[model samples]
Target: MSAHAMKMLNTLLPALVAVFSASTFAGEAQIELKEGAGRDTVMANCAMCHSIDYIQMNSLFMKRTDWQATVDKMVNVMGAPISQDDISVILDYLTTYYGVE
Candidate 1:
């Protein structure tokens, strides 16, 4: 192959690799939750102590008060140490999307 052609191939190869890598990472940036999947943040933050599925499934049948109580327990009893902003987001998600239906 010509020297110029080899040089072009090397440059193009790196560009192609970078493009593909960026595209792959774009898809993996973050998992976007639906309106009701607010508990996802909770799971991400609180799952250190237990299974996230346990929280997800249980929240499905809870009332707003139940959710508040559960959040309180996680903060006060379990000592999950979540931020107030995150706590509000999680509680809103549970009450709006995961509450008893």
Candidate 2:
């Protein structure tokens, strides 16, 4: 290749590699929620907006009330597109499985 072309490639190659490399965040994980009846509802609706790991992260400290407030925020403020029936089921699943004792 011409020297000019080689120079352009060297300039752009590192940026291209950085942009395309999967290893940067490849270790990102998904949450494995506790299995139950409403688990599917929660996964279906909640995961549409954010990762299940969001719930798993909060499951460490959040309680039933906290989950309730979170759901309220998602629905009322963030517009998560949850239905009334799905809301009830998702709340139940999150509280029962992820809530702190």
Candidate 3:
């Protein structure tokens, strides 16, 4: 490689490594979900993109519609790849366990 490219890589590599290492460490910490029906579905689908702690964090204020919108955003905007069957299970789980109504 050229000296300029090597120098650029050397300068940026440490920052990149630090970012990735932090992510790995963050992922090692587990957020326990409530034990109930459809918990498995939430785990299988939601954890693919984000930490499950978000459910608990928002539980205080979230209602059924809020959970529905969040799931819709995940599937439509964020491309979560969840199936229709799993969507119903997840909505049921969230609304029943975490949401208010």
- Rank the models by TM-score, top first: 3, 2, 1
TM-score of 1: 0.55
Tens digits of per-residue lDDT for model 3, 1-101 = 99999999999999999999898768657668889999999999998898788899999999989999999999999989999999999999999999984
Q: List the residue pairs that clash in candidate 3.
A: none
Clashes of each: 0, 0, 0
What is the C-alpha local distance difference test score of each model? 0.74, 0.85, 0.92
What's the lDDT for residue 43 in model 1?
A: 64
Ranking by lDDT: 3, 2, 1
On TM-score, the candidate that comes out on top is 3
* Tens-place lDDT digits, model 2, residues 1-101: 99999999999999989876655335334337789989889878987887687888898999888998999999999988999999889878988888898
The positional error of residue 59 in candidate 2, measured at the CA in angstroms, is: 0.7
Local lDDT at 44 for model 2? 89
Greater-lDDT candidate between 1 and 2:
2
